[model samples]
Target: MMNDVVLKVEGITKTFPGVKALDDVSFDIRSGEVHALVGENGAGKSTLMKVLAGLHTPDGGEINYQGASTHVAGPLDARRKGILLIHQELSLSPELSVAENIYLGAWPTNRFGVLKKRELRRNATRALEALGCGFGPDARVGTLSVAMQQMVEIARAEAFKANVVIFDEPTASLTDTEKDQLFHTIRGLKARGVGIVYISHKMNEIFDITDRITVLRDGQVQGTVETANTDLNQVTRMMIGRTLDTYFIRAKAEFGAEVLRVEELSRSGLFRNVGFSVREGEVLGLYGLVGAGRSEVVETVFGVRKADSGKIYWKGGEIALPRPRQSIDMGMALVPESRKEQGLVLMMGGRENTSLPHLGLFSSVSLMNRPKELAVFEKYRSVLSIKTTGPDQAVSQLSGGNQQKFVLAKWLCADPKLIILDEPTRGIDVGSKSAIHELIADLAEQGLAVIVISSEMPEVLGVSHRVLAMSEGAIVAEFEGDAMTEENLIDAVSHHRGNVAA
Candidate 1:
C-alpha cells in the first residue's frame, strides 16, 4: 500500500497568527484513486491542500512524494514534481485566449525566445479534444461560460502531465449536465493513473465520484474510509460531528397576509412572465437549474433590474418603478449571490460594512454618529454570531462562513421588512449552512417575509413553505404540502409544460 501511495502527508500541522489551521493531519493519496477531502468551511481543508500544493509551509510535519521526503517551496516547485491544484475560484486569465491561458506559465518558445503561437494552439487543442471539450482553443477565456472555463483548467492539468491533481469545489458553479461531463473527465484521468484530491461539501458528489473519503474536523483528521463502505449519514456525522437529523430544524410558521406580489414579471430574454408572491412569515423558495433566471427575477423584484412588463404590489398598493435606493427605502433588502463583489466591501472593516446601509440612521446633517454606528455593528455582531477579532477587522480575513455572516449582519442591521437571499449558503460549510437555515426559519417565525433562491435540492425542500420551479425564464410549476417532492421539482424545472397559478 505504501508503495502504491503517490503522495503522503504525515503530521501536517500549520498555524496562522491566532489559529491552528491544520493540526497533526495526515493522509495518503495513491495513483489512479480519487480521494475526497471534506470538512466544514474552516476545518483546515484548504490549508492542508495549500500545504500539499506548496502555497503554504507546514509548521510541523513531513511530506513524502514517491516514498522520498520532499519540501515544496512554491507552486512552481510543486508543479515541477507533477502536482496541480484546480482552485474553487478558478485562476484563469480572463483576458487571454483559451490556448494562451492553458499554456500560460510554460509557453512553447523558439530558439530566439519568440513565442510559438501555432505550437501552443496545437497543444491546447489536443488537450481540449482529449477531454471532449466543445469550445474552440482560440476562444477568449472570458467569453466562455464558467463550465467551459473549468474544462480549460482541466485541459491545462492534463497537458502538464501531472500525476497528482486536486479539484477544490469544482462543481460549485456547474449545472447538472456539466457535472456529469466533469465526472467523465475525472474518470478518464483516473484510468490513466492520475491521483485526484476532491474537496466539496456536496454530499451526493462525494458519494458518486470519490473512491475514498477523508474527513477533517477542527484541523485534525477525523477518519478516512472507503466510499463504498459508508453512507451519507455516516459521512455527515464525521464531517460535523453530528447526525443529519439534528442539523436543520425547520419551523412550521403560519403565514399572514401577502406582503409582496408580482404579476407577470418579465425581463425580455432573461426571464418571462415570472409571477410569485411572498406572505408575511413565509419562506418562498425559487428552485431551478443554472440559467433558469432565478437570480434575474429576484433582481427585478429588488429593483436591481427593471422589469420589461410587470406589476408589483406591496401590501395593497401598486408601487412605481422603484430604483435600488427607493426599494431599500421601502423596507426591502437583497443579499445578492456574489457577496464579495456586490454585498460587502472587503477593504472596509466589518463595522463599516455592517453599518453601510444604515448610515443615514446614524448621521445628522451629513455627519456620522460614531457611537450609534458602533452600537449597530455590535448588535448584529452578537446577533449573527460573526466570528471576528474585533469590529474593525477586515472582512476579507475571515473564513467563507464568517464572511457570509458579516454579509447577513449588514442586511439585518438595515431592518428590512422583506429579505431576498440568492444562494445565501452557496460556498459556506455545513455548520454555517445549518445556522443560516435556522436563522431563516427563526426570522420567518418572527413574522418577516423571506424568499430563498437556491439550486440545492435539499435546501429548497427543507426550508421552503412553498416551492416554485423555474425553467427557461418562466415559472413552470408550483408545489406545496405533499407535492413538494424532489421528483416533482426536478420534473417541473426540466420541462416547460406545467404552469401553476400565481
Candidate 2:
C-alpha cells in the first residue's frame, strides 16, 4: 500500500435544515488503499460521501487533495480532479444506450461541439470488456438486469480512471459471483494506487476488500482501525454504539399445515419445472444467484407473472391465481425485491404508503376516516422502529432500512396468512437487518407461512427451516438442518441438475 494521502477531510461538518449530517469528521484516504466507511442508516455515511463527491457543500471543513487544499465546486469539478462517486441508488437513464450512459455528460466532441459517436462506442466497448461484461456498447440499459446495470456504473468509473473512487454500496445489487468480480476489480484499482472508499453494511465484504475500516456513528467519527486489527463485532459495535447480537437467528419452529404448494411450474425462458411448498410457521428459503429465477418463481406464485404451465395448491386445494389481487384476497402478500420500485411508492408519505393498499379499511362510502389511518400508521411505526421525522416525511427521503420497514408495515397491516419476502434485508444496515430477522422469527412464531427469497447464503441458511436451491431456471437441490451450509448450497446450485424434488 502507498503512504501518500490522496484525499483528506479535516474538521468537516455538514448540516441540513433540521439535521447535522456530519460533525467534525476527520478522515483521510491514501493512494492504493481501500478504506471502508461503515455505519447504520442515517448515521452520516452518505452525507460524508456527498461532501467528498461535491454533491453537498460542507458547512465547514478543509478538503485536501494531492497535498493541496481546495474546495470541490461541484460533481463535475470533483470528477475532473479524479474523484468519482457511484451512488447507491442508480442515477442512470434507462432509455439511453450503455455507451451513451458511459459518456453521458462528458461526451467526446470537437471544438465545434459536434458529438463523436464512433469514439464513444469504441471506448465503451473497451471499458465493458475490461469490466468483464458480456453486453455490447449499443445495448439499451433498460434491457439489462440490475447486476448488469451495476457493472455498467462500475465501468463508467473505470473509464474515468479516477484517483479516489467512492463506492456507495456498490455490491448491494450484485450476486456472490458478481461481487467476487467487483472485488477483483477493486484489487486492481488498489494496485494502481487509486484510493477507494467502500461503504457497505455487509461486514464480510468490508473485511475481505478493505485495508482500513472507519466507523461513523451519529454524524461523527467513532474510530478508524486497521483491517487486520479489528473484527466484525467491533466495527458493528462502533456503528450502532451497542453490543449487537448475532446477525441471523431463527427459533426452532413447529410447522403447521401446508400453506402454498407449486408443482411443475414453468415459465418458458425464465424458469421451468419449479416446485416447492411452504407450511404455516415455516420459512422456506428460496436460495439462488442472480438470474437463477428465484424472483421469477415467486412472482408467478403471487400472480405477478403468468406461468406457462404449473399446478398451484393453496391450503390443500388447487387454485388458479389470475391476478395479484386474487392472491392478496386469499391472504397472500409479496414484498418485492426492489422496494422503491414495487414494494412502495417513493413519492408518497410513510403513513399513506402503509395504509394505501387497505384504504378500504378506513373508508366508508368514499369517505376516509383520517384518525383511523393515523392510528394504524402509528402502531406499525412504533413496532418497526422506523426512523422518520414524522408520518409526513416522504418515503423517498427515508433511508433504505427505514423504507424497507415501511414496506413490512404495509403488508403486516394486511395481516396476510402467507408472506413472500424477496431479499428482505438487501441494501439495509446491520442493526436494521437484525430487527427484520427478529421480526421474521416473530412472524413464524405467530404461525404465518413465510417464503423468503435471498441471494445471501448465510441469511438463507439462518432464517429457514428448509431451503430450495434453484439453478438454470429449475429446482436443483433441497437443503435443511445439517445439510444447510454455504458449501453444500453452492454445490447444489452449481452442480446438481434435473432434480425438482421438494
Candidate 3:
C-alpha cells in the first residue's frame, strides 16, 4: 500500500503569528488518483500546500516522497523531484510567448549558450498537444484569455515531467466550456499515472473529478473518504462541523417601499436590458455563470461603470449618470467582489478603514477627532465580531473573514439605505459565511434594501428573497417562493432561455 503512495504527509504543523494554520495534519496522494482537498478558507488547505511546494517550512512534519523521507529546500528543488504547483493566480510572463513561458528558466540551448528557438517551439507544441490545447506556441501570453492561460500553465507542468501536480482553484475564472476542457485534460493526466491534488470551493467539481476527498476544519484533519461513498451534505458537514440547514436558515423579513429600480439598464457588450427592483427590506439575489454579466450589471448600477442606456431610480426618483462618490452620497454602498483591490485600503488600520466613508463625522477642518473615530470603530467591531489585535491593527494582517467584516463595517458606518454585496462570502470560512448571512438578514430586517450577487447556487437559494438569473448579457429568468430551486436556477443560467417573471 505504501508503494502506491506518491506523496505522504504526517504530523504537519505550521504556525503564523497568533495563529496555527495547520496542526497535526496528515494525508496522502496515490498514483493515478485525483485527490481533492476541501475546506473552508483559512482551514489550512493552502498552508499545507505551501509546505509541500517549499514555500513554507512547517514547524513540525515528515514528508515522504516515493517511500523515502525527503527535504524539499525550495520550489526548484521540489520541481527537480517531479513535483509542480499551478497557482490559482497563474505565474507567467505576459510579455513572453507561450513557448518561452513553457521553457522559461531551463530553455533549450547549444554548448555556446545560444538559444535554440526551433527546439523550444517543438517541445512546447508537444506539451500543448498532450493536453489538446489549440493555441499556437508563438502566441503572446498576455493576448490569451484566462482559460487559455490556464492551459498554458498545464502545458508547462507537463513539460517539466511533473509526476505530482497541484491545482488551486483552477476553474474559478473559467466558463462552462473551458471547465469541460480542463476536466478532460485532468482525466488524461490521471490516465498517465500522475497524482493530482485539487483544491476548490465548488462542491460539484469535487465530486465530478476527484477519486477521494479530504476535509479540513480549523487547522485539523476532519476526515478523508472515497468520493463514491459520500455526498455533498456529508462532506460539507465534515468541513464545517455542522449540517447545512443551520448555516442557511434565515427568518423572513417584511419588505417595505421600493428603494431601487433599474429600467432597461444596458452596458454595451457586457449586460443589456437588465431590469430589477429592490424594496426597502428585500434581499435580491443576482445569479449567473461566469461571463454571464452579473458583475457588470451591479457595477453599472453602483456607478462604477456607466450604463449606455437605462434609468436608475433611487427612492422612486430617477437619477442621472452618478459617479461612485455621488452614489455613496445618495445612501448606497457597494462591497465589491475583489475586496482586497476595491473594498479596503490594506495598508491602513482597521479604525482608519472603517471610518473612510464617513471621515467628516470624525474630523474638523484641521483637527482629527481620535476618540470619536475609535468609538465608531469599536461599535462596528463588536457588532460584526471582527477579530483583531486592536483597532490600530493593519487591515492586511487580518484574516479573509475579518477583512470582509471590516469592509462591511466601512459601509455600515455610512448608514446606507441600499447595500450591494458582490460575492460577499467568497474566499472565507464556513463559520464566517454563516455569520455574514445572518448579518445581511438582520440588516434587511431593519428595512435596509440589499442586493447580493453570487455564483454559488446554495448561497443564492438560501439567502435571497428573490433570485434573478442572467445569461448572455440579459435577465433570462426570475424565481421566488416555490420556484426558487437550485435546479430551476441552473437551468435558467445554463440554457439561456427562460420566462422572465419580473
Q: Which lDDT value does model 1 have at 294?
A: 94
Candidate 3 Cα misplacement greater than 4 A, ranges: 1-3, 250-253, 392-399, 490-502
| Residue-by-residue lDDT tens digits, candidate 1, 1-502 | 3138999999999988778889999999999999999988788999999999999989999999988999999987887788998999998999999999988878899999999999999999889888888988899999999999998888877788888999999998888888998999999999889889999988788999989999998899999999999997888789888876756556576989888999988887888887789999999999988888899998888889988899999987899868888888888989999898899999888989988877788899999999988888888888888877787888887878888888888888777889999999988877788889999998898888999999898898899999998887888889998999999997887666334232
Q: What tens-digit string does per-residue lDDT give for candidate 3 at 173-225?
A: 77678899899999889888899999987778999999999999879999999
What does the lDDT read for residue 2 in candidate 1?
A: 18
User: Candidate 1: global Cα-lDDT?
Assistant: 0.88
Candidate 2 residue-wise lDDT, 1-502, digit = tens: 5799999999999887667889999999999999999999888999999898899999998999999999999988887788988887776899999999987889899899998999999999998887778899999999998778877877777778789988999888776777887788888879989999999988888999999999998899999999999998888889887776777879567889999999999998889888889999998999887778899999999999999999999999999855798898889999999999999889989999998878778799999998888898899999999988888889998889999999999989989999999999998899999999999999998999999998788898999999998887988889888999999998887775445443
Clashes of 2: 0
- Kindly report which residue pairs in candidate 2 clash with one another: none
What are the models' TM-scores? 0.95, 0.92, 0.91
Residue 84's lDDT within candidate 3 is 83
TM-score of 3: 0.91
Pairs clashing within candidate 3: none
Counted clashes in each candidate structure: 0, 0, 0
| Model 2 misplacement above 4 A | 93-100, 116-161, 497-502
